[model samples]
Target: MKKRGIGIAVGTHPAGLKGGGDPSQAQIRLKPDGTFDLLNGAVDIGQGCKTILRQLAADELDVPLENITHQNIDTDTGPMCTGTFASRVTFMDGNAVLAAAADLKKKIRDWAAEYFECSPADVEVANNKVFVKGVPEKSLSMAEVGAMVNWGGKFLVGTGAYTPGPGQQFDPETGKMTAIASLAFGCCVAEVEVDTETGVVDVLKLVQVFEVGKAMNRLLCKGQNNGGAMMGIGFGLTENVCPYYPTMDFAVQDLTDYVITTAADMPPVMVEDIVEVPHPNGPRGAKGYSEMTASLAGPAILNAIHNAIGVWITDYPATPERILKALEAAHA
Candidate 1:
C-alpha cells in the first residue's frame, strides 16, 4: 500500500543578518536591591531573545541570573538598536549586549575600587561581591555599591554601541557584490511513504543536522529546531496562500481555509544533530542558525517524492491532486 523513498538536502543561511553593518545599542544600570536593569532595543517576538540576552548580561556582570530584569524596548527610554531581523538577533544584537556588559563590568570595578579605597587594579568582582585582591572578607555586596553610587556617587550606568563596520557600497559597474557574513549549514534527510493510489505522502522520518556555532540556551535551541521542522513540513506538504490560486476568485480568506501541519502530523521518527564550529565574528562563539533549521526540509521532501514515484510535483501546495497529475503525466 505504501512505497518508501529517501532524500537528502544540504543548505545554508547567511549569518549576521539580512543586511550587514546595522547598528545596535544596549544599556545596563544597577537597581537599588543589588539587581540589574538591562535595557536593549531588541524586541522578542517568540524567538527567546529575552532569555538569551539575560544569560549574556548575567555572565558579564558576575551576578545571579535571577537578579537581572530584562526590560522591553522603548524608543523614548531605551538606547537605539537596529531592531530584530530575520537572522541578526543572535549575532548582531548579542554583540551589542556583550559590549554593554563589558562597559558595565569596567565601570563596576572602577567604582568598587574607589569605594574600597584601593587602586582599580586591586579590585575584583566575583559572586556578586566586589573585593580587594587576596582579601575575600574585605568586600561589599553589589547592591551596597549600587546604593553608594546612586545616592550621592556617580550613577552606576553603562552603555554600549555595536555596528559590524565599514562595508562596501553597491557598485553599478561590473555589478560585483561584496561578501556578507559567514553562513550556518543545515542538512536534512527525509524518508517518506507514497501511496500511489491516493497520491498521498506520509513522512516517516526526518533527520536534521545543523552547524549552530554554539547553543546559547539549549531549551530555546530545541524550540527553534522542532518548531522549524513543523513549519517546513507544512511548506512541503499542504500549506498554501490562495486556495485555488491562478484565478484568485475563490480565495478563502480564513484560517479554516488553510491547512497547516499539527502535532499529529509530525514525523514518527525525528533525529537531530548539532555541530559546534564556532564562527569567528559571533558572540560567545555562537551564530544564529535557526533561520535555516527548517530550510532544507522542503527540498528533501520533494527529492523524496521524486525518488518514490519517479515524478515531480512542481506546485506550491504539493496536494494529492498535483501528485496524481504528476504521476499520470509521467506515465503518459
Candidate 2:
C-alpha cells in the first residue's frame, strides 16, 4: 500500500468553528525488545475507548488481546487529541490504529517467512508466536522474532492518522442542514412512579434499546447504556444547574435543593433492551451507545407522566409541586 493508501472517513458537526476539523489521532511504537506501546490521546470517560481500540489492534495484528498494552490519554506522552466529545474518537482513532497494526503485522509476517525460508502465507501468528500453519510445532515466539531483527540500526515502527470525512459543512445563511457522513440512532424507555404530594419520583425500571452496529465488549456496552440512563433520569427529574451572584449575599440559591440520580433511586437496568444496528463507519459496524440512553429518556418519562396525570408538561424536572398542580388542575 502507498503511504496514504488507508483513508478513513468520519462525520462531524457544522455548528461550532472547531468541530468541523479533524476527528481523530493516534500513535504506535514497536520496540526491538518485543514490547510495544500504543498511545491513544482520546479520553475514555467510561465509554470503553481503551477496550475497543485494543480489540481493533488485536484483530488487525492477529495478536491476542492480552499481548498489546495501551497507554492512553496522557497529554504528556500521547499525541495531542481533541479529547472525547461529539462521538468521533472511536471511528477516527480506531481506523488509524488498524492501519498501524496492519503495517506492523505485514512486516512481522515478511520477516518470519524470510527467517524460516517459507512463504509469508505459510506463517501464522497468534498468542505472540510465528508458526508454520501446518507444522505448528515449528514456531518462534514474538520475542525470538524481535531478537532476530537488527534493532541497533533501526527498530520496526509505524504510525497512522485519521480525520473526519467530508460533506458535513452547512450553509450559514440558509437554515439547511446536511446529514453527517455517518449517523447512529437509538431508543429508550423508563418506568417511574411519582409521589403526587412530595413530588418524589422513584424510577421503577429502565429499558434501553439502542442499535450500536457492533458490540466490542458486551459488558462495557451495557455499562455505558445503564450509566447513561441514570444520568438521563437525573436530567429529567433531578439535577438542576444553578448560578450564583455576588449581590445575593454571595450565596447560591437552590444549591442544596438540586438533586441527582443515586444508587438508591436506580431500578433494575435491562441491557437486553438494547438493539445493535450496524453503523457503516463503526469498527465491525459499531456506533456510539454512550448518550443514546439519555436522549430517549426525556420524552419517555414525559409521556409516562402525561398518561398518569392527564396533563402535558413542556418543561423538565417535573418536580412534586408541578405534579401536584397538574393533578389539582386535572380534578378541577
Candidate 3:
C-alpha cells in the first residue's frame, strides 16, 4: 500500500500551525549528484529521532541513508520548529521529512520517464537509479537524473509542514480536565521490596506495557522506557527537593543528600509488551512513550511497597521514618 498523508501528533502539547505557533517544518533537496540535503529544525537530544527519520526517508525514497546529508538547524536556513519537548519532534518533523521526500521522488520519476521516452511506471528508484524496471543496465544514477532535470536551472526542492491540534483548558470549578487531542494509554507493574528500618526501596523487577501507535525503532523505544523507569524510581524515593525552613532562599543541596535511582537500585526491566494502535496524526502510527513510564512507575512501586508491608503511605520518598510511622500505625 502506498503510505500517504502525515502522521498524528503525540504529546501533552499538540503542535499545530495555529496553536502556539510551534509547528515543525523542513526543506529537502534531492541533488543531481546522487546525494540529498535535509534541513530540519528539530534537535536530536539522544532520542535517536535523527537516525530513525533518516532511515524512514531512505526506505521511502529507495536511497541509502548514507547518501543524505543533514544540515544543522539554523533559524535563518531551517524552518520554524518548536523546541524538543513532550516527545513531539519525531512524530511532527518525521511527517514533514516524509512529505518532502515524497515530492522529490515523484519529480524524479516524472523526469526519468521523459528522459527514457517511457511511461513513469516503467521507471523505478532503486540503489540510487532511475531506470526501466528489469533493465538495470540501462539505468541512470540519481545524480545523472538530477543533472538532467536541473539543466533547466530548476532545483529539486520539496518542503513539508506539520502542525499539531489545539489545547484543552481545565474546568476550575468542576475539577475536570479534557484532552485537546487523543490520549495514549499505558500500564506498568513493578515488584519492589522496602527495608522498614532503613526506609530504602529496592526494585526487584519492572514489567511495562504501552500503546505507542507504532514502534519506529525498538532499540530507541526500549531506551526511552528504561530511562523513564529510572526517573520514576527517583520520583518515588530519591527526588527529595524540599524547601528549607519554609523560606524560598534555601533548598536541599547536592546529589549526595538528594538521591535518585542508580544502577544498583534498578532490577531487571522486563518490557511486558507494547501494542501499536496507529495514531491518525502520527508518523507511521508512533506516539509518545517517555513521560508515561514515569507516571506508571510511581503508583506501581507504591502499591508494591504497600503489598510487601501491610501499610499505605501517602507521602512521597517513603523515607525510613515515614515507613516506620506507617508500620506503627498499621500495628496500632
Query: Which candidate leads in lDDT?
Result: 1
Per-residue lDDT tens digits for candidate 1, residues 1-332, read 67889988898887554336677788889877678988988889888988888888888778888988888668567777667765677777677888888888888888877777788889887789878999877798988877777776477777887766645666778766554565788899999999999989999999888888887887788778888888887888888887576878777677677788889989999887788998887788778788787687788888899889888777666778888889888888
Best by TM-score: 1
Which ranges of candidate 3 are over 4 A from the true structure? 1-22, 117-123, 132-138, 146-152, 166-182, 243-250, 328-332
Residue pairs in collision within model 3: 7-281, 7-282, 8-281, 8-282, 15-163, 15-164, 16-163, 16-164, 32-143, 214-285
Better of 1 and 3 by lDDT: 1
- Among all windows of 10 consecutive residues in model 1, the one with the lowest summed lDDT is 14-23
Report the lDDT of model 1 for residue 205.
97
TM-score of each: 0.94, 0.80, 0.81
Question: Which model is ahead, 2 or 3, in terms of lDDT?
Answer: 3
| Candidate 2 TM-score to native | 0.80
lDDT of 1 at 245: 68
- Candidate 3's TM-score: 0.81
**lDDT winner between candidates 1 and 2:** 1
Query: Is 1 or 3 the stronger prediction by TM-score?
Result: 1
**Distance from true position, residue 140, model 2, in Å?**
2.3
